[model samples]
Target: MRALGGLWDTTRGMTVLRDAGYTPNEKHVRRTYRRLAEAGLLTKVQDRPVQYRVESGAV
Candidate 1:
C-alpha cells in the first residue's frame, strides 16, 4: 500500500496496484483499503471519493 503514497483514493490505489503487477478493479481496491483500515494501517477520511490516510508508522 506504501506504493499508494500517504494519501490516496480508490482510483489511485488501482493504478498503484496495477503498476505493481496486480490486477485490480475498483471493488478490489476498495476491499484492500477497507482491510488496511481495519488493520490500522489506514484511516478513511472521506466517503464520496473513498479517500484514505496512511497511519503513522505504517510505512
Candidate 2:
C-alpha cells in the first residue's frame, strides 16, 4: 500500500494503521511487511530493525 511505497519503517506502518482507525500492534506490522515482501509487493532491507519498500514506480 501507499505506506510501503518507499523505504518504510515498520513503526511508521503501525502509525498509518492507527491513523486509519486500526489498532495494529508491532507484531501485526511486522507480519504484514513480511507477507508483503514474500508476495513480492515489497522488498525487505536487511537492517537491524528491517525496512521495506515497494518496487519503484509501483502503486
Candidate 3:
C-alpha cells in the first residue's frame, strides 16, 4: 500500500493497517485482496502466504 510502497504480504499489510489504528481483521485483509484481485486491480503472487500487490493507476 501507500504506507510502504512495493511488495508486501498479508501479514505486512495487516500490520500496516493495525499500526495505523485501522483494526482490520484477517477476513477483512483477505476480502480486500480477493476483491482487488477479482477486479484486476491487484496481482496475487502464488506463494505460500499469498501475497498481493495493487496495480497502480487502477480504478
Candidate 4:
C-alpha cells in the first residue's frame, strides 16, 4: 500500500485502489491482504481498525 505510505487499513486501502482506477470488491481486498500476510509480504500490526504493515523491503 505505498499509496497509503506503506501502512493501511481496509477502508483506506480500498480507497487507494479506487483512486488508482481499480474497482476491487471488499472481500477480494481482504482476501488479498490475508494472502499477503500469509506469504510474509505484510504483517498484521493492529487489531482494532485492522491495520497492516508492509514487510521490510517489500516495496
**Alpha-carbon local distance difference test for all models:** 0.84, 0.79, 0.79, 0.82
Best by lDDT: 1
Which candidate leads the pack in TM-score? 1
Instruction: Kindly list the per-residue Cα lDDT of model 4 for residues 1-59, writing each as its tens digit.
Output: 64346677788778978998999887888888889999888899988878788887676
TM-score of each: 0.82, 0.81, 0.73, 0.79
In model 3, how large is the Cα lDDT of residue 3? Answer: 43
Q: How many Å off is the CA of 13 in candidate 2? A: 0.5
lDDT of 1: 0.84
lDDT-wise, the better of 2 and 4 is: 4
**Lowest lDDT block of 10, candidate 2:** 1-10
Candidate 4 residue spans exceeding 4 A from truth: 2-4
- What residue runs in model 2 are displaced by over 4 Å at the alpha carbon? 57-59
| Model 4 RMSD vs true structure | 1.8
User: Per-residue lDDT tens digits of candidate 1, residues 1-59?
Assistant: 66546678988888877888999889988898899999999999999977999887886
TM-score for predicted model 4 compared with the true structure: 0.79
- Residue pairs with colliding backbones in model 1 are none
Error of 2 at 34 (Å): 0.5
